[model samples]
Target: MRFFEYQDRARRRLTLLLGLFALVVVLMVALLNILLLYTLVEPWQELRRLMPTAEMLAEHRGFLLWTTGLAIAVIAGASLGRLYQLRRSGGGRGIAREMGGDPVDAEPEDPKNRRLRNIVEEMAIASGLPVPAIFVLERELGINAFAAGFTPHDAAIAVTRGAIESLNRQELKAVVAHEFGHIRAGDMRLNTQLVGILFGIEMIALLGLGMLPGRRARSDPGEMRGPVWFNFALVAAGGIGLIGGRLIRAAIAREQEYRADAHAVQFTRNGDGMAGALRKVAARYAGLNASPAMVGHMLFANGAIDQLLDTHPPLEKRLERLGQPLDEEGLERLGREATDRVRRAVTERERRRREQEAAAEQRREEEENGPLGEAFGAVPGSLAAALLAALPGELARSARNPHWVADLVLYLILHPDPEIREQQLHMILETRGPESEERVRQLRAMVPEPAAEHRLPLTEMAFPALARLSRDEQRTLAGLVERLIHADGRLSATEYALGRMLIEHLDRRHGHGGKTTHGRKDPAGKNARHRENAARYLLATLALHGHPDDLEAAEAALIAGLGRFTGSLPFSAPIPEELRQASQSAAWARILDRALERLARMPRHDRQRLLQAMDDTVQQRGDPTAEQRELVRMMAASLHLNVPLPDAGELFDAGH
Candidate 1:
């Protein structure tokens, strides 16, 4: 099924869970009634027969009322206990965070924490969803994890630190991707519902225990007569209810884990990553698949191992389903191997990142200035004419999409000389008419055309202005134009200089002193104010690049760059039709924040490359929107500089 289809299925499953709960409740009531008739009330009947009088009959009725009340109290109390468990467990990190814990610093510095953060960002890009918040489980040695959230928008993925250190890149990717798949597929919603239902089922067992005490609190009544009628009645109900709830949990938990594993395999496109992970678990602790305490059936691997009466099928069986023969390797070997592969993956990733960074810096140094009068000369006249020819058809279709054109206009305002944008603005104002002749006449000078209108105007207006952001944010902001050419990884010298020049113009417009720290005259580390302003300028410049000049988006980006470290949150413009479109959301923002946190101390070139990569991804989807552009800009700004700065609004129209 498509992702949305799975989402729908999950929703339906939620209803199904409710149905099951209702069914169980009915069964419990019926069972209680039958037991009460046969046991507690039966003794009353016998006593009444012995007394042979009206007063005895009345006493018998009173005894029956008390027995029913006791049953109700037991059931209700159990229900309450289960609720209490859920309440206490809210926003929980399960066992991982509790054991491994967080470091003392405001920003995370732990290696394991860093790895987990990186994996989540990588997986998010791979799967094309907003990065969800990532969490770590430190103490768990054997492999296990779980994705928890109320919805995809608010979801979090938590993994064991052992799992982080153990799994290879692909395996780790496969694991994180698997959890993302659960989120994208809406499985988390259903899983949460299942938890609630299971709680309800357990409530019955609680009721049984609660009533057991009622049967015993009969000191006066016991002396008058054997209180077996009340005592045994309470015990029976409690025992039955508790047993039923446990059975339901076992039934629900096992299947979902298997399904989640399949999803992991599907996402990574490598059966080995997930299948290998399971093998590692078995070998690590002699088939110890114990779920964490109080987290039964909740972990990625079985927190508690219960093979015989457990919900999960055997690991070998799960592997065989993936077409892998598990018997070939011993379990411990697989575990260690999987763990080692993940570490190597992390190292290689860091290496490639460094190279990309170095490459970007080299380009920036070569062409250290923005294009002058002749830069537009680089454009071929034919391509410009062709753009003119296609403008009308392209314009009419997307003009109504609300978010479509606005981002591009914002981008233009950011890039190019202020005068260039003002003239483009004049064109926009002049060509507001609908007539083809009027449009053609206006377009005559702009392009060598039978004439362009919205399309040509929009493109010419958008790209150059957006190039004002740091190269990465510029690349991302250009996401506004559907077919706009974009270069990824390292920026060309021309692109680098173009970005620097635009920032210069912005400084003038915003009333900041021009190039306060620049050139050979001002060596590095000479000016603290310059350093502070420079960092803040870069953060604002990067974040506001493609944003629609909005306060909230700009503020968010600034905070991300210099704010406290937190889980990955989605930060892209909310696509109206969430289930259908693949777009950024608060979930992905968390991943982007982690990326920024890691690179916070890095130089601009590396920061630019990663941010651009995000933009490249959005455009690769065929046509990037304004919302996407804004998000990328914000991310680029926030990277590696979680330092506080003025609000995004104080900087530009984006802040406004």
Candidate 2:
């Protein structure tokens, strides 16, 4: 999906929007200054009647400059103040609250809401992103949904009550996929930023509104007439600023909406659901009266935007682009047909969803049997469903039950070695008590053998649960997981991946910084020698982990991977024995983390070179080993690269 490119475009658009906003603010200031000069001149003429022609108030020029500057300051200050207020509300949650949405539970009480939760989960799993919190705008009867957050980890998806009551299962799935597209392509952050920044520009209208009460007083016999004109000027200036802001907001939002629709079709591999949903929205343009002006551009449809400032493309254009071109008559006819079909299908849709979920429950093995290639970005819905199905019943329930999921994560880290297991078990028993012990014990028996591929998929499932943890509980859960891993006295690659995943997902929700490397510099070749050295350090670290017991094999793996990059840096020297010794220390964990971040931050081409070299290193023996596959996966996770798990069948010989 080229996250970097999408992010760059969003930033450029924001920059241009801000520039236009600034120009408007300047014009407003000029308008304000002119009004002040006119008002001041009226009083000056009154004084001129007292004194024949008091030298034309030359200092009025200075007053003109002063009032103009004051006007600029007032407008800028009000705008910035509004932005700060919105920013403090936090990203998606703030937007949801502003739109009158109610936060939903992972296991919602209502049956329909349960289906909504399921669809959201499927999309999150398919994309290898964390499950975003869900909300439903209960009062709104519009067929709309929007995603909001600075990143996927902190994102929330909100759907209108009308959509819930109207959309069938597949239609709802398409809507959720459309929102996920925004979350994935970094649109939500831009959407959130636009909401916050534009609020400042729109505050001019509020300022004008505040000046109205005094206007009536000015009409009294003793009151001055200047105040009335000033109030009128305030309203006019604010109206102009508001219009400019809405225009910019509408222009930026329309293109993003079109792209999001396309992304939905791409993600779902079909347009039927999206087409149906759009038809419904076209038929029902009604929106909530409470939808705030600041959020108009963030909605699935133009919630309450002026006709001239509509944030979404026309319904006809959007549907046509989705391969369901419809005219006025066709759109209305289709909407009626869809509404009837959705009503009839509701019961059947529920039945099908239940049956599919039941099959997943019965066929858990297929969940773990998907090709490793699906692990990267844009996971197929079938694979996503299989993985969901593969989850054991108890763990699956725990994933949906926010209350019991922390123990599931703790269960995965229980060591295999008897001694280490005993240590971890003791810690669990001591800190978490008998109930926690029982949960872990049952999972230990029920969890699959070797627990390699299953650990991450299971962990991914646990994200919703982890997200629901209280602050203290999250802290304690993190500490407990770390204690179990270190209890083994050595960090394995799988353990490292689990820890990173936990931190990356949970920390962001807990208010800890979880920024991605979208804007980081590609410092790869700027320091060619240093870059090569870092690459060697990374390869060496992975090699050692891949062949822990045999130092000779470890070195061989390193040499094999380095061979792929031979021509790129002929002048770089090999890792020294001292450096190799240092790489084996516990500190190597930190080194590898930094190395992965550096590689991830590099330009797309450089990142490809790095991954290619690592792949050659892993497949050097012409048969992919389990350790080799795992090392590659962990590297991808650390780099935040969503490369699909390598194709096991193609990469490995039979019975290697």
Candidate 3:
């Protein structure tokens, strides 16, 4: 099945499972009502006539009503209460913290943490997702992990220490990929919802246990007897409901595990890596010792020992599906190989540590005497390295530092014109106070003029630090950014791009946006005209930006781009008068912003087509200008496309 189809199926299955959970709650209520009637009113003598006659019902109607209402209120109240708690706790971050996870630093010093961070960053960039917050469960020694959140923006992934120390790089990559699969499939939201819903069912049992008389009770025996028997009935009723909840959870979880496993293999294109990790889990099984019931289904593997309600499929079954089922002897050999791999990894890590120490003095000397470009060139070649090299050292450092990131962002938004920039700075001083304005001025002095190419990389590097800000602080920063953008009297393309990137990232991070278009279908043609207009406007905007001096060239570029969408969308090139009007209109920024947001909701296929058209428009006239390139990157980011940015060499070659 296609990616979105899989997502739709998962949603449908979750809805069905929720219905089943509701049925379980209804059954619990019925059992509670029957228990109260049999024990309190009639006893065993009237058990055979449980359904009372009209006269008997009339006599005990109030009692039955009270008992039934109490049961429903408890169950529903607990469920809603749990849901509210999860929502307030900040989604995935809350769950990770609850499980004793510590946030991984943005630039980790340890080898394992660094490796894990690198892998997550690579996958996120490759998949066009915002890099999720990473956490490590330092206390957990089990070979398991889980992803949690309401959406990609607020999502976090936590891995056990055992998984990091035990698995080889390839095996760990497979494991991380498995969790990403969950994130991509929209399973995290469903998993979190299940946790809250199931907790309510479990609360019934907790209430029963709390109500039971303790050994130190000093109540009279006669008075306690009636209460004791009723507590026992509550416990019995709750136990049944808990079991029912687990069974339903297991049924849904097992199928999801299979799908995620398949997704891991597809994403990594390496079945043996995933199969090897599973074999190792079977070989050295140390389950997580925390609240397994609450997070069992979300785990990469089952962390509890309840065979009948195991959240994951059996290892053998999973391996068979991957076409790599192993016998006892094979497992033993794989276990030995895993041990050797871990030992080698540890030795390599030590060697790298020593090498880094030896080179630390040389790096300091180079930094002291050489230019920033020369220093950057000395670093090894990689996408991350290249992007860092392209940025000014002080600016890049500021972006990575949580304390200085806000100041760095303000500096980026400061107007180029001296008069306008002064007004913007005055506004910052007035609104953010003297201390904040001083910091922004200091940042501007450090990087007198940041290049056009520095904007995208700088904004991206600041994301992790931005996530650390409180909701109120983020909201304040967003407001300050908007005021600065409009300080110049007219919104420039650069300003619009930067503002949208910042605001959208914050929106997703806090889960305050509208529904994403993952499983949405537009079968009614309700959005067809809207989408087409968005496409036309986007292409026209890019064309106008690319060839600002020559309208003829701009029209040619626009027509070329619209050609790409001809078969699928009803797109035609705009006339020169329309292009001239668009160029002079002050509302272009607002119109372009709305267009990109609407297009972001397009299905995967249409989005890809739109991106292709945008790229074509930018490249139509020989080499694109720096502004043209920045606009393309900004547009792609807005649409949530997974396209990777060009490396440092490419950026330099593009004349940035």
- Candidate 2 vs candidate 3: the TM-score winner is 2
Across 512-574, the per-residue lDDT of candidate 3 in tens digits comes to 554333344544323777886778788887787777678778778888777775554334466
Which has the better lDDT: candidate 1, or candidate 2?
A: 2
What are the lDDT figures for the candidates, one per model? 0.43, 0.64, 0.71
Residue runs of model 1 more than 4 Å from their true location after superposition: 1-22, 40-113, 125-130, 185-228, 286-294, 303-305, 335-656
The C-alpha TM-scores of every prediction are: 0.46, 0.72, 0.67
Please give the RMSD to the true structure for each candidate, in Å.
Answer: 21.4, 8.4, 7.8
**Best-fitting candidate, scored by lDDT:** 3
Ranking by lDDT: 3, 2, 1
Against the correct fold, how does model 2 do in TM-score?
Answer: 0.72
Model 2 whole-model lDDT (C-alpha atoms): 0.64
lDDT of 1 at 344: 73
